[model samples]
Target chain A: MNRFLWLVRREIWEHKAIWVAPAIVIGCLVLLMLTGNVHLGPFTDMSGEAGLGVVPDDLQVKLLVIVYAGLALVVSMIMGIVGFFYSLDALYADRRDRSVLFWKSLPLSDAETVLSKFAVATVVIPMVALGASMVAQLVVAAGGSARFAIEGLPAAAMWRPEALFGGFTVTFLRCLTAMLWYAPIIGYLMLASAWAPRGPFLWAVLPAVGLWIGERVIVGSTFVGDFISSRLFGLYGVLSSRAEAGFEDGEGLEGLRNVDLVGSLRDFYASPELWFGLLAAGLLLLGAIWVRRYRDETS
Target chain B: MGELIVARGLGKSFGSTRALDDVNFRVESGRIVGLIGPNGAGKTTALKALLGLTRFEGGLSVLGLNPHLQRHRLMQDVCFIADVAVLPRWIRVSQLIDFVAAAHPRFRREICEQFLARSDVRRTSRVRELSKGMVTQLHLALVMAIDAKLLVLDEPTLGLDILMRRQFYETLLNEYFDEQRTILVTTHQVEEVEHILTDLLFIDRGRIVLDAAMDQVQEQYAQVSVRPEHLAAARSHQPIAERQGLGRTHMLFRGADRVALERLGEVGVPSVADLFVAVIQGARA
Candidate 1:
């Protein structure tokens, strides 16, 4: 376990994008909150009393939930991009640089090494993004609280800032849920990383794309497309399966408590989509470990 | 001393190209064995199989463990320095120490630090920040810190300047090697390592051309600087190889009586480099 942790740490040490992507995203989020210049057309804040209010406090909270959760999405997206590219790069880079032997020289087994990479993609990146989201929300909430007090607005008049933390809890859980949901996808990326003789990114993606197209042209149905769609977007399957309340109505002004951003996570957790995705991920990860062990281009 | 490495009839192929073929060798405790071969020879491939970095067809055991099946277990007792491989460029010196400490149970961080303390490498500097020579120093410091029984080096000092390269082996000899430890090294510059080699194996085109203890090489083989008057006599003895240089003939002989050869011309032990050339050319001929 300690050895695995160190391998994961090595991944973090090597890839700055894991932290940098979320930092940049949250930085933009905080900057928007500080100046109160968040204007998103219909979801604008109603509080002109602070100044020219473009985004509503409640909607902005939802937007904050969105941005916060969206950052989770963005972070997960960035992390997905990061993970996909990383998985492809990790196996190739070591061999290309001939550093595979260096790591191989260590006592850690190839399974442990490959598992550590999968853990980084599925576990560490999300945790870092979650931690970043939590921090960003806390700062924004605290900064908003200070600004409201200076403006002489009573605590009662302000949007409940506690919801930012609450919303981020949901976002944090959602990130975990996304990790569970996208495990197979990331697993495929990792498998391609280990197995591909060249350009693992293409190796990872082309087969899936070919499957999606081949199913359509040959089978003459969108049914195969839907499964690929659902396999990639289990979050939507969880979300659309429910009758969404406040934000789902699409009309707009709702209090901070009304933001049901990650409410579907409970339902998401119980669904077979998560488990099936995880099962596929586990198999793909095993394939990756097997490939890492057997594939040696050095000779 | 117990055998640290034993390989018999080892073979590996990359597509149709035989990278290693029918390779057989052994290294016992406390011996420095040089796996000498020219470019495209199986030196690197043989080392890779022993290290379990690649798979092979025949029997191979390193430190009494089947390398391919139990490589991680084998690695616990083995350390390797392949200059062709990179120590991840983004890792800091301190992080490298930390990671190794966690991954390798035998790795001693304090020993690594002690070694690093003498070098110019900074604890916080990323590997990319270090110079090429310093990276090798850092790599050496890390590998030397491991209490490994077998140290495999494949082109460990390929690109360093002469002085740094000399320092590399000198440090290995002085600081790391011991009676309990064995080293298997493959280098292009045979002269640099010939002095320290206890046994030598010459490979060509994936075949083991020669395998002998260093002393055995000196005893069984002799080079004669053929005098013009004795050129006929030396040629009649059926020298294994003859090279014409400096307006004189140099003949390499195998299993010929040393005293008899001395009567024909100046007889001396052939350098490993020259011997390698002779064996390779001889095989081709």
Candidate 2:
């Protein structure tokens, strides 16, 4: 276990983009908020609905909750992209520089090395994104409270403790589910990194794209295409489906408030696709370990 | 002393070209064995097999453990420097030290730090920022700190200057080597390592042509600088290789009677460089 932590630290030391990318995004967001460039168009429209040029206290709290959630989503997206590039580069970089020889000279096993990369992609990256998002949320809330006070509105509306707590809980759960959902992808990228002699990113993407095209040309079916799309966007599909179901009553924003984020995540966890994805990820990770063990540097 | 490494019928091929073919040799503890060979002679391939960096055929063992099967376990007792300048270019010197200390159970950080303190490598500088010689110094520092039984080096001073190469071997001998440790090194610079090598293993065309102790080589091979009148006599003794330089014909013979060669002309033990050439050429012929 101690060795594993060191391996993870080594990965972080090598791949600074894991945290830097999200931090930069959050920095930009905070800068924009502080500069008064954030135009609350939706908040103004909601206030217009009240016919008093002032948003109701309850509606204002709801809007703040939505703002916090939106920041988390944007930061998580940047982290996801960072994780993608990181996985592609992790195993291949050592071989390109011939540092794999030095790394292999140590007493760490191939399984430990490969799994540490996997853990960074799946777990560490998401946690960093979540942590950055939380900081962004606090910054936005504090800034929004100042704005509300300067505008002579009640600042307490921006500090709905229960709603803010719920927003953080839902974002944390979403980050957890996103990591589980994306495990196979992280594994596949790492497998390519381990196996490809050069241009690992192309190796990881071209094969899947080629397979989708081959299936389209030969079978006149989109099964492969659908499968790829479902894997890539399936988590959002689950979330949106539950969201749309809540909107069946035509509640709009109120409907979003009623959407059970935790329960939808529970449904995602229970799906056969998630379990099968995990299994496939396990096999791909095993392939990575095997490739790393037997693949010679010269080859 | 026990055998530190033993290989029998070891074989490896890249596509159709054989890099190692039916190679057999053993390294005993407390010996510095030089694996001497020309380029494309399978020196690196054999070392890679022993270090578990590549796959091969036939039986092989290092410290009684299968290198390919139990590489990580074997690494605890064995260490290798594949070549100079192979360290990661982006890592800071301090991070590299920390990593080795954490991963290698037998590594002593204080010893490594002490070695580094005497060199010009800065702890905060990335490897890429350092010169090639400094990079090698850092690599040697890390490897020398590990308390391993066998150390394999493949051209460890391949690109360094003369002074650095000399210092490298000097440090290895003075601080790292002991009675309980064994070193297997391969290099093309025969003269630089000749005096330090306790044993020599000459390989050619994917096979070991000669394997003997230094003393055995001294006893079995002799070179005679023959006068023009005695050239026929030296030739009759069946010299393996003959060269004319500085108005004298030097003939190298294997297991030739030293008294007979002394009677022909001035005789002396052949240098390793000369012996390696004679042996490789004889095997080819």
Candidate 3:
């Protein structure tokens, strides 16, 4: 257990972009908020004697959905962006500099080494994203209350511990769901990173793109293209399909409010595509470990 | 204190080229064995096979474990500093210690810290910021701290200056090696290690040509110089190799009676370098 933790720590040490990149993005968002750049004019515009028209009676419910989901969306998306580059570089950098030799020289097996890296991309980084999102949301909430107090309105309702804590809890669950759902993609990028002689991104992406193009041109079929799109965009499909089924036709926001991840995750695991994608990921992850184990450093 | 390594018919090929071919040897505990070979003689390949870094075709065992099949378990007792500098340059000195302690079950942290304390290497300094010699010192310190039974060094001082190179071997000999441990070292600078080795294995073209105790090398091979007039008599002994310098012909004789060679002219025990050349030439002949 400690061994695996150290390996993950090593990954964090080497890839500063993991925390540094998201931190910078969050810093910029905060900076914008502080500088009065986020007016929320369209969302908050109102005219009333007490100026409380900006926040309606159902404003807390709406804000709960919007803030939590928006923060979760922003953080998870930015994490995915960072994860793409991180997974691409993870296995490649060690071999490029011949640190693989040093790493393999340790008593740990190749499986342990590669799996820790996979865990970093899929599991650890997502939790970090979740934490970043929660922190950012809290800061923004604090700012919102500060602005509300400056105008002599009641701010306690907006900063209620229960609502804010519930928002954070919901976002955590969402991030966990999204990252697990995205594991196959993470595994693929890491496989490419492990095996590519150079330019791992090209190695990973070109084959998929070329195959998609070839399938479209040669077979006149959208199967492969749709499969790729489904993997890329399937989280929303998984979340919304059940949500849409549960609610009335035009009630997406309300359906989204009822995103029951545990029940939905059960459905997610039942999907044939999910099983197949995960199987493929398992095979590729094994290949990555095998490559790390057997490939000679000098070559 | 028994046989620590045994390899037989060990073979490996890289594409059309065989890097190690039908190699066989054994290393006993408490001995320092020098694997001396010219470039492309399968020295690195054989070392890699022994270290479990590569797969082989035939029977090979290190510390009673199949090196390739049970590499992770084998690594607990075996350590190596390859011919190249392999420490990741991005890590800090302290982080490197922390990592080794975490990854290796047998690694002792205080020993590593103790070793580091004797040097000027700062705990916070990145490997990239250190001089190459300092990096090697740091590497030696880490390797020494590990309680491994067999240490394999493939040209461990390949790029260091003379003083540091000498220091590397000194540290290995004085600080690391013990009656319970074994050391297998490979080097192109044979002369530097020649005096320290208890046994020598000279290889060429992917095969080991000479495997003998250093004392046996003294008893089995003799270098002699004969006058032009006595050359015919010296040739009767069938020298393994011959060289002409300063109007005298020097012959390297394998398994010849040293007393007989002394009768021809001046007879002496050949250096490891001379024996390496003669053995390779003799194999060709």
**B-chain TM-scores per prediction:** 0.96, 0.98, 0.94
lDDT by residue (tens digit), candidate 2, A82-144: 998999998999999898899998999999999999999999998998898888877776776
Report lDDT (Cα) of residue A164, candidate 2: 78
For model 1, residues B78-173, the per-residue Cα lDDT tens digits are 988877337878778889888888888898888888888999999999888999899999999999999999898989998888998899999999
Show model 3 residue runs off by greater than 4 Å: A41-43, A47-56, A151-154, A237-272, B225-229, B245-248
Better of 1 and 2 by lDDT: 2
How far is B50's C-alpha from truth in model 1 (Å)? 1.0
Could you tell me how far off, in angstroms, the CA of residue B46 lies in candidate 2 after the best superposition?
0.5
Candidate 2 C-alpha error for residue A207, in Å: 1.1
Q: What are the models' TM-scores?
A: 0.90, 0.96, 0.92
Docking quality of model 2: it rates as high
Off by over 4 Å in 2: A47-60, A251-257
Lowest summed-lDDT stretch of 10 residues in model 2 chain B? Answer: B81-90
Looking at candidate 3 chain A, the ten consecutive residues that score lowest on lDDT are A40-49
Better of 1 and 3 by TM-score: 3
lDDT for each residue of candidate 3 in B115-186, tens digit (9 for 90 to 100): 888888899999999988888888888888899999999888888899988888887888888889899999
Query: What DockQ results for candidate 3?
Result: 0.68
Best by lDDT: 2
Best by DockQ: 2
